[model samples]
Target: MSEAKMNPMHELSDNVAVPFEQARAMPPSVYTSTEFLEQELDKVFRQDWLCAGRSSSLPNPGDYTTMEIAGEPIMVLRDRDGSLRAQSNVCRHRMSTLLEGRGTVKSIVCPYHAWTYNLDGSLRGAPAMMHNTAFCKSEISLPTIRCEDWKGWIMVALNPDATPVGEGLAEVDALIGHYGMENYVESFCETHRWNTNWKVLAENFMESYHLPVCHAGTIGGTVDLEKMTCPEGRPAFNYHWILKDNTMPLTLAHPNNTHLVGDDRNKTYLLSIYPALLITLTPGYFWYLSLQPDGPDHVNILFGGGLAPEFRDDPEAATHFKALKTLLDEVNDEDRGCTEKVYRGLCAKSAEPGLLSHLERPNFDFARYLNAKIQGEG
Candidate 1:
C-alpha cells in the first residue's frame, strides 16, 4: 500500500468532523492486532532511532550492555578509545550468540567457537581459524549498528539506511534544551513485563484522557487535563501533554531548585517518541520509559527517572524524589491494569475499530505515524 493511501490525514480529519471539543476515540485494532504489532516492529522499532540507554551506564571503557530491539539482540559497548558502539550480538562465524547482560569486558568471545571481538566490534582473533584456508579474519567483523548520544541518552538504529538520530530529533532537541538533561543523574530504574500488546502501552502513554479517572490519586489532581494539547501537522514522532499544579511554585523553595520558579515550576510535560520511547520532563526531574515488544501480546516496559544532579546531594530532595517515584509507580500500575483488560477485549470476535477523540490527537497522530511508517509513507 502507498503511504498516502495508508495515511489519509485529510480523510482522518474529515471523518472525525467535530471540533476539538468533540473528537472521537481511536479504533480498537490499534490495541489488539498481533499482525499489526509485527509490522510496527519492522517499520517503526527497527527503522526509528530508539532511546536505548544512558551514556552513564557505560561510564568506563570496556563497559557494555545488551538489549533487544524488534527481537534482535543488540550489544552496546564503550571501546578502548572511550567511544560507544552498537553491534548485532551474533558472531559472524556460525552465527553464535556473543554477549548477555551488562559488564566490563575487554573483549567479547563467542562461547560456541571462542571467536573474540573487540569492543569496537572488530575481529580481535579467531584462534583456530587462522590455520583454515577459507577463513578471512579481516572480513569477519561483527555487523555494526548506528549509535548516537544526545543529552546523556544513547540511541541506536538497526537500519543502515535509517535517518540520522540528530535529524529525526532536531525538534525535540529544541523543545527540551531548557531541561538541561545532561546535568541529571539516573537514580531509579525498573522494568516490568506486561501481558498486553505493546501498542496498548504506547497508546496509553500518548493520551491523557484516562488520567482524570485512572490516576486520580497520583497525578490527576495536579494535571490540568482540560488544557492539554498535542503536536499537530508535524511528524507524529513526538507528543506533549502539560500538567500544571499550584504547588509547583512552592516546590522551587526546595534547595538547589530555585531555577524552576514561576511558570515552569509546576508543569509536567509528557512526550512519546513514535514506537517505543516515552519521556516525562518535570520541574526538577525527568522520567524515561522504553517499551519493547516481547510477543504478540506481551511487552517489557523499562522505567527510569531521577533528580537533576544539582539537587542530588540534598536529603530533602531525595525524600521528594521518593514520593514522586511512588506516585509514578501507582500510575503505571493503573495503566498496566487497563492494558491487560484492553488486550482481552481485542481478542473477542465482535471487537471492532473505534474512533478518535479531538483530545486524543496525540494518540491519533501516533496511529497515523505508525500507518505511515508501516506503509513506507514516513
Candidate 2:
C-alpha cells in the first residue's frame, strides 16, 4: 500500500533530467524487431506478475484455466480443497503441452504420453511405461508456477525467483479499497487480437492524449478533458483522470441514475498498473484492460468488466451494460485503427521515436519506467 517501495534499482544519471519536460517516443525496434520482443519476454513479462484471468473462472474445485505467459503454456486449477494452483502445461516426460485451453478436469492427462498429474501438479498416474522405465512418480511431476488471486483477479509469474505477486500489487489493492472489487462479480469479458505493438497499446491507455481525437463521439462529450491531471512527483506509476457528467444526454440511460450522476457531474479514474494492466473505475462499474503480447507487432487485449451485486440481476442494468460495452468498443476500435497505423509508420525508415507532450505526462512517465526496466535499472 505504501507505494510498493518504488523499484529500488531506479537511479538518476547525472545527464538524465528529472520532472521530465518532454515526451520521447520509443524506438522502432521496440515495435518491429523480433530480437527486442524476445528480450521483453525474458526481461519484462517473465519477471513481472501478470493478470492472467478472473478468479470467477476457477471458483469451484477442479475448475481450471490455461494461460499463456511469455509464450509458455501455463494452467491454473482449483485443488480439491478449493485452493488455486498454477503449473506448467508441459508434460514432464516428453515436454509436450498438457492443457489446450480451459475446462474442469479432475486430473490432467498428457496427450503425448499417458502422464497424468493431479490438480496440485503431482504425478497421479503413468499407465504402462513407468513399469519398464526407472521413473520415479514422485519426481516426475509438472513444474509449478507462482499463482495468486487478489481482489478477484488471478495473477501469474513465470520466473521462480521473481518477487511475490502480492508484494508487487500491494499498492494497487490499498488504492482501490473503496471500489470493493473483490465483492463485485465478473459481468462480462471479451478478448480481441490487434495488430499493433503491445507497448504502443499500453502507452496509449496510460494517457488521455488521444481521447479528444479518437473517442470524441463516445467519451469526448461525456468527459471533461481539462480536469484531467496526472499526479506529480510520482513518476506516473498510476493515474487519475477526472471526467464531468454528460452535458449531452446519456447515450443509454442507466437503471439507477442517482449514483450515476454526482452533483450533476461524474469522474472516471483511470489507473495503469505498470507494464500491462489498466483499470478504469467509474461510479457504476469497474473495467479492467489487460494486454498480452503475441509478437513484436501483435497483441491480445482482454476486456473484463465488474458490476455491483445489486445491478447484476436488474434488467435495466443490462441495458446500461450493453451501452457501456458499445461505447468502449467504439473507443477500442479507434485505438486499434490508430495503433495499427502507428505500427506501419514505425516500420518506415523516416520515422523516429517522437517526444511526448506536457499533457501526456502519464505516457512519458510510463515510457521512463519501461526504459528503466528494459535496461535492468529496475
| Candidate with best TM-score | 1
Candidate 1 wrong stretches, greater than 4 Å:
1-24, 231-233, 246-255, 258-261
RMSD per prediction, one decimal? 3.8, 5.8
Report, for every candidate in turn, its global Cα lDDT versus the true structure. 0.73, 0.71
Superposed Cα deviation of residue 108, candidate 1 (Å): 0.9
Worst 10 residues of 1 by lDDT: 4-13
- Please report, as a residue range, the 10-residue window in candidate 2 with the lowest summed lDDT: 6-15
TM-score of every model versus the real structure = 0.87, 0.86
List, residue by residue over 62-176, the lDDT tens digit for candidate 1.
Answer: 8987888988889889988889899999988899778987788888999998989878788988877656898887777888899888778888888888777778777877776
Q: Residue 145 deviation, candidate 1, in Å?
A: 0.5
- Per-residue lDDT tens digits for candidate 2, residues 263-316, read 322556678876788887665566787888998778987788866554565677
